[model samples]
Target chain A: MVEAHSKIISFASYIPENYVPIDDFAAPADMPSKLDLNRITGLEGHRRSKENEGTLELALQAATKCIERSKVDVADIDLVINCAVGSLCSELRSKLSPSLANLIAEKLGIKGAECFDVSNACSGMVTSLMIADSMIKTGQINYALIVAGEHITALVDEARTNNLWFKSKALASLTLGDGSGAYLIGKSELPNQLVFSEPFTLARFNKLCVGEASKNRPGPMMRTKAAQLQQGVMGNLGEFFIRSMKYMDLDWEAIDHVYSHPTSPRAVKKGAGIAENTVGKIKRLHNESQDIANTASTSHCMLLEKSVQLNQLKSGESVILVSFGSGVAMLAMHFYLPEGIEQWS
Target chain B: MVVVRAWKSSSEKTTNLLKTICNLTQNLLSENGISFDDIGVIIHAGVYRRNFRTEPAFATHIQGDLKLKCGPVTQESNHCFSFDVSDGSCSPYVALNVASHMLRIKPEKYCLITIGDERPNKQSNWPYQPITCVMLVALEGAGYQLTGTNFDSSAFDSSTYVEMIFDSAKSANVIGESSSAAQINSDNSKFSGDTNWLSGRHIHAFLSQFTEGTTNTHEIIDQSGKTVTATWV
Candidate 1:
């Protein structure tokens, strides 16, 4: 029987130094700026990578910080899972082999850790969390490091210069920022551990947001049915919460904080409204996308880190994390924080 | 004990990864008298994808294609979890290890693991033939039960491995097999296709020689020189 549990010991995020404002997005060559992207997406600005800062470098920074804060020796780490959707290097080259997890483990001097990559769009970090939790519970491994480094703003550049399909497809690209997040998970018998987690994919909406290599220039391109994607996710907002809450045998009142994917300010507000109607009023909801933009897989962790820095979270307080990805994948996790999480920051 | 309920394989030269995976999954479910709702989790383990596409996991596409409980999970809805686990050719064993733990913890009756890879695009270089395999695993079954598994990896800096590289002339990212990769290949078992699916083929061979009250042990080395050893009794 699986009797053990896993708790997040420490976490860290790395945002590049280059910050780009919303107004900097030029109108597509073929069309005028009819839509106020800042007003529509609720993003003031997002961070971009400086030269020589790619997914690998960003991930290394975040992972190193996470390991240092964890206070766990590097040799004791048993597994490394890289969940970066944009696995691009500083050279704008794609990395598909040897696994980024292997590279990160090599850089960290952690030998013999089982390494792999998980791809679940934006839900990747949480998905990897579930996997790590399972392994810990089943006594497979003692400690696991799950990391994501997204240098995806290259898609924004692709969206800006695109002459065709700017509004319908490339609009969501502008709401992106380059960032990375890493979490160190270890076995814990303490009550303040991951209680329950569930991840689902409403795959029917897979085509709503598609990313591929740019045809017009170098780098990547993304086309998103922003409005429709929001609709599909919102349509089931109530169900996602209810089911996850039920599995954990808890209700909205039991949760101390709610951290949602920071896709956009408007969307976060809209989702809160929908949740309020079905799942009762949330005690506290953290929305941090206005500054960092959508950091893809790292959004939830970034929010957690922010809340820790602000000293808004206390030890043993229950929290809920909500996330969605391009596969129309959704994840909900109910967990309790450990002692001194703020000091880890 | 976690056991293999059934299995399916494909080597069709089709670039449509989702379509191929959907067909195999449907057939596996129907032949086993299982409904799509009976599945609680789906894990896709593939390395090379068309166009080096990264978002929206291929496993989700399989679930969506088959319409496997494709709705928001309410109190009454049967939810299916889907994601991809990419580990070069060691994906199948890694996924199997993950499934074993999940079946012990969750109440799910079955888990599906699928693997295959195709040339990213025509402009990119591909050294192997396209191949895919899907395995249905369950906690209570009458097939090979996974008893134990182990993994060991050499130093990444010194290991000779196959990896993806950006091709400037082709203007695309393609699979780049290092010169030392061939040297490692010489020590591996020769299959018709590339080494990515060697673990899948290894397990398939183990199943072919299954015997009652007997134990089987095998090891496979991935392109990155990670060795996975599995014991079935």
Candidate 2:
């Protein structure tokens, strides 16, 4: 029960205060009412960005809060990874003149940091965190700052307003909200709280979910077969969950909690059914999608942060972070929250 | 230490983007007397690409192009998954870092690191275009051990630059395997510290010397007057 790998030192998240309800989606009159939409989608509204907001800004806000909360000087941070560089929800998503991580490190006064950006759709933050974790575990760097920002409104805007992208059936974009999440992982004698981590991609299903720079619009737009994508993801999740439990010698019954990335309320419920099969009876933590649609890569961290803030997570507790996203990439992490961690900054 | 096999491929605008990556993978495997069956995973990095209009991960397309399959008949149970690592000029190094870690963990696995550059057809800073290099690194107990891997973003002189890399190597106790090579990406003004950068062709020639075998530890300077030392035992 005391076994662990890397401990999560600090966690922080930022969600834009702007709210855009389903009513503002510009759906046709034939579409379902607000109540039905809520009932069907399990989502009533999501956070949106105000004018002049972008991925870099949101990423900075999240990183700043994380660094500030960690009580560690910016100079002490050895590495900074921007997990939302190319996949961020902004018109400049594709543009990489000034890297997001480099800029953030500069502003934070982290002059001695090794920085890079890792983009793998929604599993990005975790992917970057894994890189930092490996670096720390391998003795390359001690402290790594991992951040992801999704100002995905531009794509949602393109899908809603642009005639070229006006595919009424493509509703995945409608569920996306804007937010950023950051985590600080350091190597210490404090025991390994982050036990197991892996990012696996099934290229066969990569086409199911993706975000790209819209041809007609300047910003990036995403198209996902919400139902079909959810099916593929659940199937993969079921396989990974069963296999991981065996590999890590974890008992489905002993597992304290299961936190999965939620795209929609309906999707969460459907995924929960899969969860039940593996663990018999499972406790699921998925409020990101419910509160802020699909925050893409930041979903896992945001969910973790929320849980920490609510005091739902306790020290020495075992939890599984299940994230599935674009490219159909699946990232599963096994963690033991260290004792004495106060709250998410 | 395992034997590291490297293969490089470059093309002009005339070459198809996908063909470049696919052919390079096949050729590297054939030259090494191995097949996709022997490989663990493929990691593709196309930091400079014009054919990204479809989707982000061209690694998937590369897997498809190479016709790699994972099933009951494929020898390996899990089909290897590929992902891109984008870090501008540092793309190959980043991919190498990831591959190194993978190989370190799964010693029986051979990770293929692929990087391509297809610059847009325009008069630009980077005269290099349509370049792809594949490095096959594994933990076969016979390949070059990447004794030290370094990434420094802050400002530094050439000594500091060399120290960031070599000091760690010294600490690791690897004095000099044979000859050390530096890829002075003249385009990286922050790190390269070059006033006039070298063309891709020139850098290509400099790296080709490694394959031909080196006589001594040489410090090869690109047209940008930036130095990168290369070593071959």
Candidate 3:
């Protein structure tokens, strides 16, 4: 039997303060600021970096906040994994994750920490948790910090102007936002009450949704047509829910909360049918914080943190977090909020 | 039956260098009657030409030529002597890992291709650094088949010999030449040209430690168009 090893000690999210209405931001005629776009999408507002700030800067800010709130010593951090959809390094030739890891370590005064980046589109946070859990269980590392930061708004224009789908499905343009979310996972001697159960992927649908543009000018471009996007969502959402249910031996009613990839209102409603959630246990932040829609993998983490802050979820409650990315990659993991950690929310 | 091809050192544009190496790789694949699409996945590994800041250093260059529908790309950057010298390995791994997940295969099934061309200007970042890039491809299915293995390096001093050759060439080439040549010479002089100097010493030191007192020498030719030979003393 797979053993449960690590528990999330603390979590935090950062969004810029500015807010923009959804209609104002999504209008093709208007050029909305990042703050406005994030606000309209119902994201708490993505943390905006100075014009000169890059991926590492945004990541550092969010990570520092999580660390500070946790009051955990910097030296105690054994590993850091930065999961972002956009390029994080000034030098694409080197590992952007480790570079950011090094920067965070230096700033936090953490010595002898292993730092790297993980990219799996929307499923990045869940994947990072799996990796950290394995490492902790195997005794490779004691504490692992998973941080995801994205500025997809920067890529939205190119995606909308160049891609046919974004032009047609204008609603999606509003769904893409910017923000960062972080979680601290550490080994707990206490019995693992809530552990990462299992992870499965539907790779055949990997390319169904993605963000890419021209080769020379990199930006967010929707590769899959809108039809494929619909099909992918319909096809994989069922597969993910069914597989997760079978693996966990959970019925639809057993799931206490549904933390879904906040793609759109329609998509979320459709997803409700797949997960069999007749009750309104589904807590969504995508529409509430348009500023940070589809923060890629960080979306789930940010949403979870928000749910906690809103006092919507409680300890001992089972939460199912599902993430879907462009490659049509789908990931589902079951988790529970530990006892004391709920107070921070 | 498979053949092995190696591009040791070169003076060429980064794209050209990559094209040449990939061309050689394609030739090997074609001669074996293998189609590019049938190959499934390609892994590019190495620690050279970590200069470009925007384009994915590996996939961006090869995607057009290979006509690859969609696959992963990754590199090994930890081996760099310094930050300036090391290319990031994680970016490439992201691409490769995604491809692997899509194809539903192990890391060993994919074919890995590593190519690097360190120029004189890049020496400050340790160009010509001895880095290993590997490509793994599975023709039969997902699993990789390992037929033979060998790791010995004690017979020849690659570092000392490389330094001698580079030092002699630099001293000889320093004499009068054209304006462009002079400019190249000046640039080379700035970073202590002789790209192979530092690399040679490092390789020798590594070999000495790796082989200990044993006489290390080995060679192998594989069906996957890969040939590896090493000796250290």
Tell me the TM-score of each prediction against the true structure.
0.93, 0.82, 0.60
Per-residue CA lDDT of model 2 for A254-327, tens digit only, reads: 76877777777688777778767865677555454666777877877767766777778777777887776566
For candidate 2, the share of real interface contacts preserved is: 0.18
Better of 2 and 3 by lDDT: 2
DockQ score, prediction 1: 0.59
lDDT of 2: 0.60
Error of 1 at B57 (Å): 0.3
For model 1, the superposed segments whose C-alpha errors exceed 4 Å read A26-33, A164-167, B104-106, B155-166, B181-213
Which candidate leads in DockQ? 1
Write candidate 1's Cα lDDT for B1-233 as tens digits.
Answer: 37888888776676787787788888988898987767888888877777777878888878888888886667787778788887666677778877776665456888988877766678765656656678899987787787877776772433454545667776665656564333243233322223454444555555666666967665666655666666777
State, as a TM-score between 0 and 1, how close model 2 is to the true structure.
0.82
Sort every candidate by lDDT, greatest first: 1, 2, 3
- Which TM-score value belongs to model 3? 0.60
Task: Kindly state the number of residue pairs that clash in model 1.
Answer: 0
lDDT of 3 by residue, B1-233 (tens): 01112112233334354565566556655565555544433433333333222112243244335544332111210000000111122222222323333233222233434433333222222323433232333423322222222211111111111110112333211111111101112221111223222222222233333433443343321111112333322
- What digit string (tens of lDDT, one per residue) describes model 3 on residues A193-216? 334433333333443454432233
**Candidate 2 Cα errors over 4 Å, as ranges:** A1-5, A26-37, A85-94, A163-169, A190-192, A338-340, A343-345, B1-3, B50-56, B69-76, B105-108, B119-128, B140-145, B156-206, B211-233
Clashes of 3: 49
